[model samples]
Target: MSKVILITGASRGFGKIWAEAFLKRGDRVVATGRNIEALQGLSDQFGDQVLPVQLDVNDRQACVEAVNRAKEHFGRIDVLINNAGYGLFGAVEETSEQEARSQMETNFFGVLWVTQAVLPIMRAQKAGHIIQVSSYLGLIAAPVLGIYNASKFAVEGLTETLALEVKAFGINVSLVEPNGYATDWSGESAFQAKPMEIYGPVKDAFQKAVSVPGFFGQPAATAEAIIKLVDAPHPPLRLLLGSFAYPSVRKVYEERLASFEEWKAVSEAAHGSN
Candidate 1:
């Protein structure tokens, strides 16, 4: 089926791959980014099938207007990919409030704005899918990527609740939890915090881990997995996109389960046998 798809952060990385894939498959794509020129190639290649819109997801009004423009041009959007966020690499204490808030604005609130903008249209159409391009950090926290983890965790919570709330309206919400992928995410797309003496070693370890050869996977595979999820008759609420995601997230959940089990008696006793 030829569907109308809107993707934020489509200038590069996974978003660009998704846009091209969808266009090649004959779907109408509304590719949005901060740089209009970066997306001109898509428009030139796909012609009317691609609408390259310059967008800043942090602006809620722009998000709403972008949705309106897409709906006007393509009639109705069948899918929306919230993929506009970037990484904030810092320890919790090293990250200033302003930086943390900016991270949340882009990764969490921006997703909320986009979803809110699309809900009415999907409800009226009686069908749609919202895919959040979250990270594995959403499910498991790391030492230095505290701010990024928190933002993605918020996204996870919002997306899960949204899935339950909108299912009755025939809208499916899915979180694409990808592990480290070979993208600009760790370089130019990422934000590094001001170094603190206390966090130097921790930061070094984090950087070392990231710089390890072959640690990151490919973005094309992640995009392909997302396409499979979207094509499903009933897509999952959480789709782990990378090979490492399942085991990594599983370990986190298992550790959490152990902790809860160890505290089960105390937890139950706190209820006072009521």
Candidate 2:
């Protein structure tokens, strides 16, 4: 059976790759992006299997309308991929108020608004899947990407709670955390903060880390994992893409556990004589 999948940020990158993959397999997609013309190619190639919608996910009302349009056109929405977001690169001290808020608006609040709009429709159907495109930085942290990391961290928390809350309704929620991908996320789609000389060394170190060989994975390689996730009867709460995510995150957890154990006495003392 062909499923109705609604994907945001379909103009390019992972969203476009996954949308085409689904359409090639006969699934219907409600593909959305800020530029409708950029999405036209999907409709052109896939015919009626794709519905291109012009959307700016930061607008809460627009998010709601997009969901309504999908429900009306497809009769039901079987899957939603929240892939509309960009990276904000800068040090914490150098980040301006507007930059931080804008990052939160698109990366964090945008996901919230779209998810809220689709919840009622999915609840009525009694079966649906929500896939959030977060990053491995959501689980760990990276210098010069403080704001982007914060946004994904918020997504990780939100999706984890959503999974638990919607389990009884037969709704599945999964966080797709991809570690450094060779995409335009670091190029045209990215927002850069005004550089400060004090942080030059920090910025340089971050740049060198990313330039290392084999640090990034191919974006198209993720399509198979995403398809498998949506097709699973019982999908995972969190799915980490790319080879770097697993071992890297595992190390972070181990270090966290050790710290927790080291502070066990202090933590217990904080409870006082309750």
What is each predicted model's overall lDDT from 0 to 1? 0.92, 0.96
Candidate 2 residue pairs in backbone clash:
none
Off by over 4 Å in 2: none
Q: Could you give candidate 2's per-residue lDDT for residues 1-274 as a string of tens digits?
A: 9999999999999999999999999999999999999998998899999999999999999999999999999899999999999999999999999999999999999999999999999999999999999999999999999999999999999999999999999899999999999999999999999989999999899899889899999999999999999999889989999999999999999999999999999999999995
Clashing pairs in 1: none
Clashes of each: 0, 0
Could you give candidate 1's per-residue lDDT for residues 1-274 as a string of tens digits?
7999999999999999999999998999999999999999998899999999999999999999999999999999999999999998888888898999999999999999999999999999999999999988999998989989999999999999999899999999999988899899988999988878998898888879778786699888766777798899989888887777898889989999999999999999999954
| C-alpha RMSD for every candidate | 1.1, 0.7
Output candidate 1 Cα RMSD: 1.1
TM per candidate comes to: 0.97, 0.99
How big is the RMSD of model 2?
Answer: 0.7
Worst 10-residue stretch by lDDT in candidate 1? Answer: 218-227
